[model samples]
Target chain A: MTFVIQLMSGLAVGCIYGLVAIGFSMIYRAMGLVNFAQADIMMIGAFLGYAILVAAPGIPFWLAIIGAMLGAALLGFVIERVAIRPSVARRADQVYLVLLTLGIGIVLSNGARLIWGADPVVYPTGLTHQTLTLAGYPLPAVYLYIAVVMPALLVGLHLFFTRTWLGLALRAAADDPDTAATMGVRPALATSVSFALASAIGAAAGVLYAPISYVSFDMGVIGVKAFAAAVVGTLGSIPGAVLGGFIIGLGETFGGQLIATEYQDSIAFAIMIGILLLKPTGLLSGARR
Target chain B: MESKSPAALALTGIEAGYVAGVPVLSGVDLEVREGEVVTLLGRNGAGKSTAIRVICGLLKPNAGRVELHGERIDGLEPAAIVGRGIAVVPEGRRVFGSLSVEENLLMGGFAHRRGIAPKLDLDAIYTSFPRLVERRTQLAGTLSGGEQQMVAMGRALMAKPRVLLLDEPSMGLAPMLIDAVFDMISTLAGKGLTILLVEQNASEALDVADRAYVLERGRIRREGPAERLLSDPEIRASYLGVG
Candidate 1:
């Protein structure tokens, strides 16, 4: 029973990492950009959820999550339009684009610090502490929520990408922008939509995560673990991201028993390096260079 | 040659290149009349592909004007150019490797997709290329080279384009496949689709085209009827490798 409980908690944490990693993979696949600001977008989403809850104290938790996702998506759209697009239009060097993303990440983290203050804020929901018994075993209610919500999100994303024309356009533009253009797809529009979709996914992770842990401006540091998860799973594959998240989360939980707690963060990177050394393209990757 | 139909597509004195000062296509003029099949023939670096790029709005000419039935289109974005009924089957049969064949066809119809009327029919496309019907769900990248070329052509045709620009449609294909492609081109022209074909295979290109232009060093060195050029001693020696 205790092992099962530990596994459930590990899976819950893995879900959070997977959500953020999806954003990383989406943006990376679309534009070959490793957006450092993606995790910080999660931070901003948490703050947005908090602000929304404060504004309407009686609002449902789902509504708050939606509001936060929409807010972060708008911010992502603005960032792509105001900053990323111009640099790309001018044909900036690849190194410059990478640095630009790093700089934007710094600005976002520090900007959140200024706006939300340095103190950690707790979610005002009673659901955080709520518990339920499943087959005579006690389980955190938030874990149940995470389990339901993650699968729901995965289904929604799958439908959006496969069953919709906009999704087809996004994939087409990402694969071959020049050919897509000849086929009458506007590359700029496809790119903007990709950024918005990735940001919203990140924001969903933030809202889901806030009930369990205190939301801080620097909470985005967890992004590195998610990045490792993305790389480990396969940088651009969505399923790979989710699988990577589980590996990291479960590894950390089990390794905590054998190793010092101080080395917990190092485990994810260690796994990432090990995977890369064995298979540089990643476990699920189709050998993309 | 004078025709009752105005120039369906025309490029006047187009000058363009990858580098700022060095031009690959310099002071080059070409035209395709309505329902005409015009072939541009040249050696490896004679700028045949560059001319196609200029006409399709892929590369903005440093100084030139591209026209569709007299209206300018050079400075427009490639999507806008396609929206105005010009579609190009780019070199190398660049099918979206990850997307399914049906998805690729759907993307081609994206411009006029908003209206209730289905301007482009998937069933029609599938019927035209019977081989594609069975492979509709397969990723384009996994297909053989000839199948990818069919997908590229069907994708371009999905736009219901009035003018079709084909860039080396026979490139890297088996001789049997090349004949099949030329037969398809002849059929498209029979249905009154204006075409601009760029080719290195001079004999087959001249066989399928009504008119031919020879480009050398970014200049139009020869212009005449396709059959006349086919029998010319100079063209026979330089391009056809015949005495």
Candidate 2:
């Protein structure tokens, strides 16, 4: 019963990491760059949703989520255009992309700090803090919400990629930008669209998380786990990202439980290094290059 | 006897090179008439592939003009040029290795910005490459070289290109496979597709080409009807290694 509880708890958090990892994987596949600022977007998104919900108390919590997503999408699009695209046009080194994103992460994190301050704000997600007991084990209903919603969103994303033309165009851009261009997929458009989609998803994770936990500036620290998940799943694969997230989430939980709690973070890193030594391509690497 | 059709694609003075100091294409000129198959024949390092790159907007020419159906298209991006109906089967059969055969076809169908190409669909592509139908779910990188080539060609066809540019379509293929590829090329031409086929195999290229241009160091050294070029004793002996 404890194991099942731990697994569910781990899965709920893992699904959030998985969502953020999807953003990282999609952006990496499309632009050949790891966006370190992905988690920062999560923090900012939560704040935006929180602000809107506070501003209009009568609005449903879901409306705040939609508004937050729209905010993230527009902000992400602008960031790609203003901050990322010119550096790309200049044909900067791969390291430049990493550095640029890191710099952006610092800026966004600090900017949130300026607005929200250093304190953690309580989130009124309107869900009663009810605990559901399964076989004498207590489980937070919020985790159940994440467990169901995240998978549903992942399925929706899969459908978008496989069934829709624009979604196919995004994947095409990731596969071979040059050949994708020959198929009339504008690399710029693909990049922008990817940024928008990724940021929106990141924001969605943030909104879902804020209700369950305190919204704070350093919430992005959790993003590092998601980044690790992306690396463990092989850098650019979507399904790999989700699987990696779940593995990391579960591993961290079990590691904390069976071993020492303080070493949970290191478990993800240890697993990453172990996988690198054995299968450097990652457990679910789809990249041939 | 020249079966008359207007030039569907044309290039003049296509000066291009990857490296700044070395020009791969210098003062090259070529054209493909509507519903005709034109082969750009050259030996290795003869800028045949570069010419295709320039025509397809993969590489910009340093100095020259490219036109399609009498409209200028030199400065446009590859995506826009693709939207204008120029599709390329690039050298070495550059299939998206990670994507499935079906996904590859879907990628190829991204030839338009908004909608699927009406002339080609998953079923249509599967019909054209029956082997691909059998292995639709398989990853493209795992396929044999000839199979990869079929996917590459099938991908281009999914675009329903107005001017198809094929770069060294026979490279790294078995002799029988080369014949099969050429037969497919001829079949595509028979269906009124305008083709610019680039090849190092002059003999195989000439067998299917309606007109031919001999590119030597980025310049047209010889140009004529394919039959005329094939019959030229000195040309055949010097370039094609036949007499």
Candidate 3:
């Protein structure tokens, strides 16, 4: 029973990492951008959700998720247009773009600090703190929420990318921007949409993660682990991101159980390095250049 | 034999190149009238592809005026040009390899429409290239070279373009595949589609074209009825490899 509880708990955390990693992989695929600010976007999303809850007092959790996603998407689009597009239009080097994203990340976190103050904030809901016992073992209710939500998100994303014209256009644009333009897909629009979508996903991850932990400006540090997950799954592969997330999440959980709890973070990196050294292209890498 | 139709697509005084002051196409003028197949015949590096790129808005001309059906379309983005119905099957068959063949066709019709159910357009493409029917769900990158070429052409056709530009349609194909490609071109022409074909296969191109232009070192060296160019001893020796 304890083992099963640990498994579910690991998977729940993995879902959060997977969500954030998807944003990383997607932006990388669409614009060849690393988007270091994605984690900060996630941080902003959590704050947005918290603000919405404070404003409304008792709105449903799902509504808060939607609000955060929309707010983050708008921010992401504006950031892409204002800060990123100029450098892109100039055909700046990849190193310069990476630095630009790093600067933006700093701006976002610091700006967030100015608005929300330095202290961490907690949700007012007591339901998230409730613990459920299954077979004489106590499990966090957030894990159950994650279990249901992750599958739903996966299905939604799968249908979106496979069955929608806009989704197909995004993939096409990422694959070959020049040919996609000839097919009537505006490259600028595609990049903007990609940024918006990635930021929304990042925000969703933040919302999902907030119930399990305190919402703070520095919580974006988790984004480093998610980055490790993206690299473990291959940089631009979607399914790989999810798989990488599970591996890191479960690995750390078991590693902490077997080894020392303090070494959990290092364990994630150890697994990532071991996997990269062996596969180089990641576990489920698609024809990535 | 000229039909006296107005120009469906026209390029006037186009001067363009990849690098500044090293123009690939210098003041080149060409036109494709409605329901006509106009072939641009030249050797590799003779600015044939460069002209096609300018027409499709992939490359902005240093100085030029591109017109479609009497309306100027120069300085527009490539997507805007595609929206205006000028579709190009670029030099290489640059298909979105990660996307399925059907998805690729759907992308071609992206200029003006929404929703996933553009069934009529997909049906037309599948009807034209029946081989694509079975492979619709397969990733484009997994296809053979000849099949990838078909997807590229079909993708452009999905736009229902007013004037189609084909650049090196016969490139990197087997002899038999090249013949099939030319036959498809001839078939499309018979359907009253206006076409601007760029080809190194001068003999085959001239056979299907109403008129032909021979571009030499960024200039129109010769242009006339396709039949006249086909019979020219100099053209036969230079491009047709016979006299």
Predicted model with the maximum DockQ: 3
Worst 10 residues of 2 chain A by lDDT: A121-130
Writing each residue's lDDT as its tens digit, candidate 2 over B1-243 gives 554533689898889999897999888888888888999988899998888878878899999999998888998999889888899999998898777788888777775435545334778878878899889888888999999999999999888899899999999999999999999998998899999999888888999999999989878999999999999997789777977
Docking class of 1: medium
Docking class of 2: medium
lDDT (Cα, tens digit) per residue for candidate 1, span A1-289: 5777777777888899999999999988889888888889998999999999888987888888899999999999999999899999999988898888778888988998898899998777776688888777787777777887899999998888887878888898999998888877788888889999999989989988888777889889899999998999999889899998998888776676468757878877888899899989888987421
lDDT of 3 by residue, A1-289 (tens): 4698778778878898898999999999999999899999999999998898889988888888889999999999999999999999999999999999989999999999999999999976654687888778888766666777778888888888888778888898999998888878888898999999999989988988898888998889888899999999998888888898999999998888889979989999999999999999898876532
Chain B only, TM-score of each candidate: 0.96, 0.94, 0.96
After superposition, candidate 3 runs with Cα above 4 Å error: A287-289, B1-5, B112-117
Looking at model 3, give its docking quality level.
medium
Q: What TM-score does chain A reach in every model?
A: 0.95, 0.93, 0.96
lDDT of 3 by residue, B1-243 (tens): 555645899899999999988999988999899999999999989999889888888899999799998888989989889888899898889989998898888888887566444557899899889999999989999998899999999988988899999999999999998998999999999999999999999999999999999999999999999999999999999999997
- DockQ, candidate 1, comes to 0.65
iRMS (Å) per candidate: 2.9, 2.9, 2.6
**For this target, which candidate reaches the highest lDDT against the unseen true structure?**
3
Each model's total of backbone clashes = 0, 0, 0
Q: Which of candidates 1 and 2 reaches a greater TM-score?
A: 1
Of 1 and 2, the candidate ranking higher by lDDT: 1
